[model samples]
Target: MSERREHAEPFPDGSHGDLRADCERCFALCCVAPAFAASADFAIDKPAGQACPNLRQDFRCGIHRDLRKRGFSGCTVFDCFGAGQKVSQVTFGGQDWRRAPRTAKQMFEVFAVMRQLHELLWYLSEALTLQPARPLHGELRLALDEIERLTLDSPGALLGLNLAAHRQGVSDLLLRVSELVRAEVRGSKKDRKKDRRGADLIGADLRGADLRGANLRGAYLIGADLRGADLRLADLIGADFRNADLRGADLTGSIFLIQSQLDAAKGDAGTRLPPSLTHPAHWSPGDRKVGPVVGA
Candidate 1:
């Protein structure tokens, strides 16, 4: 099989672009934290908290040479926001979690927290690109400050975060940002159409949100709880869902989004499977496998 080449368009000239390559610094946390089922992309089943078969002892992909051929397409989409390396080199100071079994659980928890915090940074960085959100720039800057402070917290403090409250705060601000950006992107003349460009929706609890056919082009959705989200026909071009929960999210007709984005978003059995995702048999998460994307 021919190797697929997917070049990432970094957010360009900022912390976002700089953070794009940070995954290598950590423990490959995304691969171990998520679960998966057998599909065209994977040859077996794997579950959360278990190391993927494709993962090597050196913290590299064993099948990097043929990830697609080996049925692990989902692996292609994860972006750790440099948390993997931060947790590995900086947080744990190059100590292997496997060797320090006493701290393994802590390591996992820290990994999870750092991942969320990093995801928030991704959105804040993107929000800078949205020229229309100029009015809210002050507010966005404040929010970014709050999130950045959280990133510097100790592992113990990070694990103890009041994530619910934090999410609520971020969600409210993101909604305002979204509305403002949407107004400019859609313009006053366009009918009451959906417009969600550059919204800082990180960690927004959008469970069962009605976004069907809504225009979410270039929206920053990192770490948003999209459980049971209605993404049907939603124009999701350039939307960033890194670390966002997409369990039960219907993305049937959403255009311009790619499997790489989905790979970063968290999904579970309750998560509605997109046809484009191939379930890998190496996935120990569950027995069920995801079918193919019909349109593609």
Candidate 2:
């Protein structure tokens, strides 16, 4: 179990505190906290709070090397946002749930809450770095501090946290940041149509589209032809990117896009990502080669 979270993008300049998953300090909370169905994502069904069948006694995945081959492809894309380590080491004081069965339920519940808080931290950290969002830096800093504080609270305090309320407040600020960033995009009148927020564009033919600063929030872009599309500064929060062809697409400076969104899409070396994100290792050259741009 490597101490790396798939969704935890590093701070661009290494100035901010770490949010990356440190599995070395974790007790495999992700393998036990969340429930999984015997579907395309998992080989077998496991209820919440139950240890995964592949979990070893030492809190490591028995099939970590070949998880995708064994029908756990979804696990490869999942990120706990450093919640596992925080729960195991800090919150529980290095006490393993197996050694303290009485605290297992509360531990799992708190782990879930911590994961949410950590996720908010991940996005907030990125939002604070955006040049267009400089005006909201103070608000972002406050939100980050509050969320980080919550993550350090006792298990009971975490369980009692109003997660929904906090998320809503942060979300409103993020929306404002998106609007400011997108408004700065200079494009022709035809390019203005690319602002398709919450559009049902599943499998749309958007090849070579100049979608700079588009409001693509919550858009269903599964299997969309995004080859070489310019998505810089686009608000991609909640956008469905499964099976989307991102080969050669420029996502530089995109806002609120998470690693899970990239993991679900097809991209290659030609895909340009933000400074904080690393390209998915699973993507291969054969998945989606760079093709000719229809309108460049």
Worst 10 residues of 2 by lDDT: 287-296
Residue-by-residue lDDT tens digits, candidate 1, 1-296:
11223333434353455445454566666667666778754677888778887778877777777775666655665556667777777778888777787777787778878776766666666565456567878887888789878877777888899876876676576556555554533444342445566777888998998776567767889889988887765556568877788776776544445545766567755454444343222222664445334345
Instruction: Assess candidate 2 and give its TM-score to the true structure.
Output: 0.89
How displaced is residue 281 in candidate 1, in Å? 23
* RMSD in order of candidates: 10.8, 4.1
Report, for every candidate in turn, its global Cα lDDT versus the true structure.
0.64, 0.81
Q: How far in Å is the alpha carbon of 228 misplaced in model 2?
A: 1.9
lDDT of 1: 0.64
- lDDT tens string, model 2, 1-296? 33233433356577444467778788888888889999876889999999998899998899898887888877877777778888999999999899999999999999898988988898888888777789999999999998888888999999999999998998898888888777777466865877788999899998888888888989999989999998887889989998899988988778888777888788888887775666677776543322222222
Best by lDDT: 2
In model 2, which residue pairs have backbone atoms overlapping below 3 Å?
Answer: 3-23
Best by TM-score: 2
